[model samples]
Target: MTTKNLLVELFVEELPPKALKALGEAFSTTLADSLKASGLATAHSAVTAFASPRRLGAHISAVRSQADDKPVSQKLMPVGVALDAAGQPTPALLKKLGALGFDAGAVPQLKRQPDGKTEALFLDVVVKGATLADGLQKALDEALARLPIPKVMQYQLADGWTSVNFVRPAHGLVALHGADLVPVQALGLTSGRETRGHRFEAAIDPVMLLDADHYARQLLEQGAVIASFADRHAEISRQLRAAAAREGLTPIDDAALLDEVTALVERPNVLLCRFEEEFLAVPQECLILTMKANQKYFPLLDAAGKLTNRFLVVSNISPADPSRVIEGNERVVRPRLADAKFFFDQDRKKTLASRVEGLAKVVYHGKLGTQGERVERVRAIARAIGERLGGTALAADADTAARLAKADLLTDMVGEFPELQGIMGGYYARADGLGETVADAIEDHYKPRFAGDQLPRNDVGIAVALADKLETLVGLFGIGQLPTGDKDPFALRRHALGVVRMLVERQLALDIDALIDTAVKTFGPLVADPARTVGLVVDFMFDRLAVSLRDQGYGAQEIDAVLSRRSSRVHEVPRALAAVRAFAALPEAASLAAANKRVGNILNKSDAPPAAAADPARFVEPQERALFDALQAASAPSAAAFERGDYTASLQALAVLKAPVDAFFDGVMVNADDPALKANRLALLASLHAAMNRVADLSKLAA
Candidate 1:
């Protein structure tokens, strides 16, 4: 019925800030689970974690005083045949009941209520209570044992004692309940009522923790450390943006940088630093890369979005002279930018237009041959993709763009920094007097560099992007570089998604199998076996397409059915989805689906082989003749509509057979004694199959 606050802290040498953030969560979750398993009714809320380079601590709101006690019941099967030979309480039964804590003196009188019923009895038992500290300590110990310490080592204490292995050296441990210390001796730690302040700025030997709230405050006041990472992160962002605003420049928004910065400092001190303006003559990308990749500084940009010479650096310490730190950082970053500038200038000596021929030396992949060879394959594939979408006006231009898309890979600038691959190509292409469409395609072909990024814009760009990705996919599958769980080294998943986005967004009519075949064939002598490569590439695309469609709102089962029956005609998937939606819209569609199930059930149960129904003279009933007539009429319209990709209209035509087929099933017996009559009825079902198979195997749809 009573509750108390719980505090657990791990004190050690400096931990990587990232590890601390993750471990804080692990501690809260694992500890909560352990307490619940012990049957304690505790509200583990208000989890507060604060980590410096040295320690990680979490505080819980309230934990129950003791685990809820319940009387556990046991069933003992009666032993001893014939009950001691006198039908009495056998010695075996007495011993079994005694071992279960049932008091023999207090056993209740037995009573019988019905025939074949035995007497019922019970003995009252009470369980001992456990203290809050006992339960919490057990739970915390279990959780700590499982806490993943990426690195650990043994420690020695002054008392000539050895401690449990740990990452870095363990200094102390603090475990608290309200104002009391819960003693623990694991890992050479004496359960204490105190923890330390920030490693760099602590003035006292140790800060005493009287309570969870005061303990957190003392650490901050003594060492200038913030307890909660969320608050610290907000403060860092505020200061960095303010520092950037002083020069009318903006801080580049980077999630990875923000996360790394959060781990790099306990108390972030934002400062403005500048480089010589002459460095701005280097490309904006080159300047930013120098600051971000090398110095970990947040680059600032001018109002016009140009990279400024100034940057904002966040420091963990508030030094007496911040200007000195700024100058030291500037000295380190200047040389890096100069090197990038040198690479950029040297690369410009060879124009991107001239670099097109140089791609022949850069291998795209062993099986894919050289980048120059890939360009040739892409030129043909892009033209095919372009023509299929009715973009002939720009088809020639798309061919030109695809041919030069990877040309910049040969340039010195892109060679030094591969991230600027397509970007440098676009810049060079435009400078060489290429048309806007051609130059734009050279850049935009790599629009979706990752999942959730924007896709290529124009048809030309989309076509070329698809070509490049498909070639990679087919070539890799031919050589077996397919992805397994989380091991996509070549980013094949992104390429697959790019293909899905192109198909769904561009609305292009493409036979994916044919496209894969074209790409595989382009490999020519490079691919060992084209047939197996084509199948693997086709299957990969289907898997990726299934995932994409499910994300678009289709169920997995439906996607499997559609893909199995029509993966080759991938462009027809949208039409098929529409047909499915329309079939569901019909009021009679439900009943029709039921009828279809009945037909399949009957066919499955039938022992005799079904016969063809081409002989009309075998029809003994008028209903059978009516079914045949309707099937004939339905065939023409359905085939015509399906061929033109009008799936909804095709479904409407198939609906014409509903009445006649239902009449035949109701009036005539399919298993007739007459052989010809039985054969004709089976043929009628065969005709229905032929008609529906033209669109999709309707049998796979859910009833």
Candidate 2:
């Protein structure tokens, strides 16, 4: 029953930075999980993961040396087949007992239990638990096998003839249970207490860990390395903030950049480096991106959030003077910044208008023609959308913006940094003497690109943005390239979600179906069935909208009720869902919803449509007459409120129908013997159904 903390580490060549965090977590969790599953670790054991550029490891607490032995009852075979008629052991029983390492004397101890129509013999035995060494070895093997390795490298081991595959060349493997080294082997290395520290700054060569819990402390003290990835990242972040604060500036906040830098260094020493102030003449985005993406540096920002010439570098070694490190980083970064400035300056020599002609040479997709053709389609769609939103002025600006948008793709700045496509376009548009509206639209057209991202700043931008997204969706869908599962090479799902977000969040009055139709028409003979394509695109958008609404904390029933109506104006969906939520809270909501479902089923089964109104003379039951009167009273106000956009009030108004509806169904037979009576009842039910579902399909809320 003795337990001890366990530690395991695998040291190798530098791992992929982006995959380090995931790899660390997966290795630790998988190792601990495998141990627990084998009963060598308790459920309450604590596990801590450590990862650096060169290693992945785990520290687990309260791991038992061996699991407890348990008595197990295993069914052998049917009693009839195991024993003779005289209750003596048959050859089958003797053979089964012999296979289980039991002798003939053990046959009398077998138990019988009825299993369906026959009795089965069962054997009870004690199962020995796995030893710590065996369990740890198994867990380590499984963990390595299950690692999320981005790529694998095959290399020969020291034996020269033997080879191994791993994320990198494995140098060492450490596995310790408390103070003792557990006998485990992995990646062509045996378990040991020795591991290398920082490549250049280790206090000692082949740092030796004294105990299972001393791995981290020894690494930091003697190895000159911060072994834990999270701790190292936090330390780097702290130093960066402190260094920037001393200069009265703030370091740019980028989690991805932080992680990549953390992975690149072991012991982080923050140093402030600078470039020529003249480089600031280029767009801050250009300089900032060059520093971060190419050099893995954090660009400092002034109080006004403007990029400063000074930047912070996280170095692996800490020198007493630190002057050489600072100067080396500055020298390395100058050319990158110069390249960015050069691209920007060279790009301005030729206007964006000149680059428009070059787009014809760039292929967008094999089936979608050239970028020039796509730009024309986008311009047409944008013009149509702009005219619908605001007359000729907006249309002209949108068309101009759309035409110039793709021109930046050929510019030096964008060619060097593809992420700056739309941004550089906006800059070049302004330099061309185009007005603010056109420039802003050019940049903002790619707005709301992802979830929670901002939408277009102006009506012109909105039109252009909508047009761009619609063109992408319709074009790809027409080519039978619809997104299947997770393989959306064209990002169709993102494009669809962008459209839905703009339509619903902006509360735009545009009709989704009509917009899709317009977009499809812009493709000319490329699309086969414009009408069917419209339906497919609309359905796809609605599906994305439903998922989005659910993520926003709306219930499935509420979303279903509103979307089930197939409301073409997505802007009204939120209001409809709100109304549904309010109506569902009413005491009579359940009955009314159920009654609405009943009415729909009856109408669907009918061969003819219900009459427009119920005849008073044909009403035979008092309940039927009462329901008709209630319907007349509720329908008028509900319809008026719905027209005025008071969806909540519209739905609430139908609550009055619950009693009458329930009573009519309970007391009156809707399919009466008389033809006129049955027809009249159906008509009354139809009117009631129409009144209740003005905002959403109430039947969806029944459950």
Candidate 3:
């Protein structure tokens, strides 16, 4: 059958901007997949997706008008049930054949095949092909049903009380194959070669599409719209940069903001707009957040990344004289900025100390107490960790920062913008004459809010951040509010990951187990079950660490080798992993790894621990004595290297015993006839195992 390109579109009212891109992708992909599965499109067919503020469309190349017939094997029934004792047809067989429009004459052509454990009779037949009309209808219905719409609306059609549910009220449907329209219905509308475009700037309303291949071109030339989402996004990005470049400034790099702007416009016209320079007096974060979140604008930055008075607006319409558009946006944004400034100024009148008492009224969690109680717990944990890392001075700074960290939760600025809790606290700290160390600590306590985000910049910040995350994790786990599947209401995974990054990246001397203990102890009587909760929290942190390691490109075996030890000192994990990777590359590594596994198996099968160390006087075989001497000689340098944290060198120093280990295993049996000799050999193997696995368990490297 000859094939033709196909195009389909659904035109509607303005879509939700944040979900437009995803909706377009899901619609086009699901449609293409359904067509391919039904054999109406081949594997090599090309699919293009088009989306804008008013429409979603898909264009697929090399689609067939009819799918080819396929031969199918149909299992009739078990042979035992289909035939009589003499192998003649029975009533059951005759009834089954009759239902299939067949007679006894067709039995001679039937094939017998094994089905599970019984022989079954099968009939071979050709299934009819589907026409383009039926196939396209099914594909369109599947695509609409599978769309990832967050919410749907139910509205009545033009016919009195008949209603349909969709993401939005559909106004039209377009489906075309080559130059002809395909008959398909959706949302009480039939397919046509007509779609509406840019409501204001379109040169033609209800734009007439000529053919499947001319949809995009016709829409662009006559409809005054850029139909492709990606093309529109790239065009807006280019214009924003070009406009910003002329002023010697750079636009803020926010992909999400760019995407939302692209979804808000059908024909993008980037224009430069500005707010009063006086607005720059506020912190750039507040100004940028207000402009981007409240007004959907992009704030420009100087070379030093300082916020500028001028910003860019992506307007849907482009007129000859654009001053009015710029003025209109500026006028709308000024009051928002003024409100932010008012909040900031009024908040500074009272100190953080005064606001600290107000936290008692704010509930953190029902099971857990108020934010005030949580702050006290964080302060205790932070001070304890600080004292371990630095001394009294660091502890004092961390304690002070932790106490006031949540004070901003009561500030007017933070009340207006909950995302600015920590940020506003830092500003208030600076204005209150607190040192930069305390201010930075308060600001950075929420560091690493997501994956790939930076950790705290200083020791004080690290201490407080660690305390805050630990408190959340332990408190939630204690109350049985652990994350299950994907429902992480409190983002416990992120908190656990934040703890992992700080400990590993900072190379802190504190142990993961010890830190959990500290956080639990600080909660005092609040934690319901500290012992069980500590175990759960520890396991949770390790799981997060494994995920983090995998994301960094380490293989499973290498991770298992090091993590099997379950070392409390998580800071040493990276160096330990590096050591194991180096050791696995040696020529004798396979033999040594296997031998280490064998030795471990031998030691574990014994009834009890070896009573004494291996003695040279009891060594009767030459290979056994050779292995003992080699281990004695290699012990010093390996021990010295491990003491100084040279994990790679420590593991490498023991590679010299590979030959002796192989020979000793081959020449001697660990379980000898004599009890004393057996104990001696087991002791010798135990010594070798200890020295080899100091960095990582070599047995884990065995296949």
Clashes of each: 3, 0, 0
Q: Report the lDDT tens digits of candidate 2 across residue range 1-703.
A: 7899999999999999999999999999999999999899999999999999999999999998898887999889999899899989899988989999998999778899898999999989999999999999999999999999999999999999999999999999999999899999998899999999998999998999999899999999999999888999999999999999999999999999999898888999999998899999999999999898998999999999999899999999898999999999999999998899889889999988999999999999899899999999999999999998899998999999999999999998998899998999999999999989999899989888788899998999999999999999999899899988889988888999999988888899998888999999999889887888898999999999999999999999899999998988999998998899999999999999999999999999887888998899988889998998988898888999999999999999888988888899889998888888888889988888888888999999887
TM-score per model over all chains: 0.81, 0.97, 0.98
Query: After superposing candidate 1, which stretches have Cα over 4 Å from the reference?
Result: 17-20, 41-46, 49-52, 73-138, 145-168, 200-205, 240-250, 301-310, 318-328, 352-416, 431-438, 597-664, 671-679, 687-698
lDDT of 3 by residue, 325-415 (tens): 9999999999999999999999999999898888889999998999999999999999999999899999999999999999999988888
Model 3, stretches more than 4 Å misplaced? none
Error of 1 at 554 (Å): 2.2
Tens-digit lDDT track for model 1 on 1-703?
Answer: 7666777777777776556667666766677667666655354455666555666667776666676676643334432321456646555556656786543442333222222354333333445455666766776777667777666667676677655566667777888777777766556677787777766776664888777657677777875677666667888899988888777789999877776677677778998988889888777887787688767899987788878778999888888889898888888888888898788777767766687788788887766688888889888888877777656866787788898898888877787778888877877787788867877788889867876788876778888888888888887878888899989998888898888777766676688888888888877877888999988877777788888888889866456546767556677887777786677567656655556656666666667756654577777789878988888888888888988889889877878677887798899997788776766676677666667645555566645
For candidate 2, the TM-score is 0.97
Ranked candidates, highest TM-score first: 3, 2, 1
Which run of 10 residues does model 3 get worst, by summed lDDT? 197-206
Clashing pairs in 1: 14-53, 152-166, 613-683
Using TM-score as the measure, which candidate wins? 3
